[model samples]
Target chain A: MDIKEYKKYAENRSKRTSSLKNCVLAFIGGGIICVIGQVLFNLYSIFTIEEHAKLLTSASLIFLAGLFTGIGWFDVLAKIFGGGTLVPITGFANAIAAAAIDNKKEGFIAGVGAKMFIIAGSVIVYGVSFSILYGVAYYFYLLLI
Target chain B: MKNIIKFPEPVSIIQSASVVGKLEHEGPLGQYFDMYEDDIYFGKDSWEKAESEMCRRTLSTLLAKANMKYIDLDLVLAGDLLNQCIASSFGLLDCNAPFLGLYGACSTFAEGVIIGSNLCSTHQIDRCAALASSHFCSSERQFRFPIEYGGQRTPTSQNTVTGCGAFLLECTGYPPYITECVIGRIVDSGIKDQNNMGAAMAPATVDTLMRYFNDSGKSANDFDIISTGDLGKEGYEIACELLYKNRLDMWGKYTDCGMLMYDYKKQDVNSGASGCGCSAAIAASYFIDKLKNGCKDILLIGTGALLSPVSVLQKQNIPAVAHLIHISNSRN
Candidate 1:
């Protein structure tokens, strides 16, 4: 079809497109993303990793997933799974991955490295800000105790 | 828990204007933006930049009309449709408002209002502003892709509104006092159609409304009107059906911003509803018009689908989000 005809039909095509293939793929992709978490849960049974350490592993896995997403691989996976790749914690990993990768392509100092941490850095700042507030509140609670 | 958050002084909204639908002479180019050298939303210019500029310009005109000193104002609490709020950051650079950038997709306007109202109520700043802006071209490119990239659109897909809307969320001790935030609910109906975002997001609207109704100890009938952000026609009907199916009654004076703007027949407004800007523009412009002319209490429900085109293309069903803010002009 010509471009104009394509534009007219595109809307209809999007609706008619089958979700079955995508849905199955998404389920599989999403399941794959969570497979690591499932393994870590099993490892928790085998070896007594501290709860915090276990949590760190989960976070790290998500971060690693995000790192893959940044490289553009995860997005492709996300596309196939629809919400499967996206609905999980792995989606966030993809966002960070995409940002860092985009920035890196520009060059590290200003482009890649500087830009990589923009959103993540803010999240850290906000995290610290709230943490300090909680710490102060805890100190007051201790004084009352 | 009581916490003190400092903010800049409050400033009145001296003036405001919104551009909606297609412009007369602009041709395919919907609106003029000073931020873009080319002013084309579909080109290589970052969509994040395009949307931000839309918001900045809208706010600038409003501020300029009010003749308020930007330096005198306390802070700008603003949000956008971008995932991490890249548009808002770039948007504020032009307006130069000290900003606390926020993200809630379509809900950003109400989120801005709630925060601004809280700061204003605390008398932290004599006057403060909360604003949310969205643009279709830029949003599509960032989250979906360039419009020209020409992927298929669904009949369920509403054309993304092209303009920006800004609200002056002031704590002018403006009589109504914004005493409470009856938070909107987030419901996700497992509908995977990205084209009919309104239908997918309707469940979130219903869930949030139900929660708000329960929390506020109020019924849907309590408010003068309960308006939704987008949801167009199909979503609106779906929402009604879903509400009825759940045995919840929300039958009166409810409307959607998508349905309100543009004539589908005349303008060929293909999809039933669309993006974050649809609600932002409606709330800031249309609703504000009503409020200025003494409209009473209202519940504005803003909805957003968190899914991107990339995710959809990969066959991901959309997950929806919504937030509700109850605005009242009543005095004690």
Candidate 2:
């Protein structure tokens, strides 16, 4: 069909699209996601053990985020924010916590230990898997050196 | 010949444009950021700020497109996933449109449409508009946890779309007919796995889709397209399998908002999707594209998981629901 014809038809079908309310909910939900991130950053800054401890702070943030994911607070945020909560460092935490929590009910060894690795393990595996592939390039650099 | 009732006036496109913004992953915002961002640590706050900025930009584009003044619109109807509807409210501030805040989880889009259609249909407000926006950040913090608290996520978990979508519906002298009322049904499966939301909400999606088919007395083949919200790969597969098993073969085209919004190849996202806005945004952008292309009869199914983390932690199973909206171009 011609451009004009297509445009006309498109407008007719467009009504089915979600109205403004849904978008607003999502936007607010997105904002809520950021608020949590800010709070975490603030807490990390306040609990500084040493000067210029960026690595330590980052690690703690990751751990705390995961811990909250386990306790169910992060999940609640996920529900409220929708995509907002799931897209950040908090999501990583949620993944780890979910694995650990999911395993906790089964038992510490196979359940807890095995389940805890459900998501984190995958991250590590993927990380290692890709690093190995890319690490080959590093080996070449070492050989050249 | 079907005696279809047509609203004397049509809805006009006073103006329309989509805006976008970026965010950092941290706390509340991270929830949304996590949905779509592959490598980033921005959180809900960043999502919120970005979302607000997007709305402002979209509103500006709408005004520019329509070549009208901000004060021209009689009313602005909006909604979001946050507690007080901050992003919509804040972003609309730039648009200068009068506001009406609403919530329907993922169904907010329809809510806006119904209300906007009514306002224009009744001629109660001339030149009124409706807008909707969803961001990744703000949603995470309020519904889940703060970044400072930190947490772990499940593989079944869906990452929020690190993006926002908006729509502008205007009332015109020649408005699109508000044909049939396709209300959503709340179906609960009592399954608590957030990761398996598609499974949890599958029943609802199927139930609603079939019911709408029965109510309309129309077969699945009658519609040109069928769409669902947030049912990603698992939910989508389950929906088709169950529908096929029940002998309710959906012959029409079908798609999910979660699967289409982002390119998985570039992102490598596991399982298709999440986020209430997934359906909303898809319905706005993609659906419009389809409609404009001449495909008429359409079915829109929006699925939502009513299971909260607190409820799950409290030992409650998850419950999911789906709402079906029917759309067509048979208004004459």
Q: Evaluated with DockQ, which candidate comes out highest?
A: 2
Candidates' chain B TM-scores in the order shown: 0.81, 0.78
Shift of residue B313 alpha carbon in model 2, Å: 3.8
**Could you give candidate 2's per-residue lDDT for residues B28-87 as a string of tens digits?**
223322123332223223456566665565566656666877788788777666667776
RMSD of each: 17.5, 17.7
- All candidates: DockQ: 0.03, 0.03
**lDDT, residue B21, model 2:** 30
Provide the fnat value for model 2, as a fraction from 0 to 1: 0.03
Summarize candidate 1's per-residue lDDT along A1-145 as a digit string, tens digits.
3334423332343344367876787788778768877777677756766776577667877877765664446645554566776666665455555566545535778875776654456766887999999999999999999
The global C-alpha lDDT for each of the candidates, from Candidate 1 onward, is 0.63, 0.58
lDDT of 1: 0.63
Best by TM-score: 1
lDDT at position B46, candidate 1 = 54
Binned by DockQ into CAPRI classes (incorrect, acceptable, medium, high), candidate 1 is incorrect
Chain A TM-score from candidate 2: 0.57
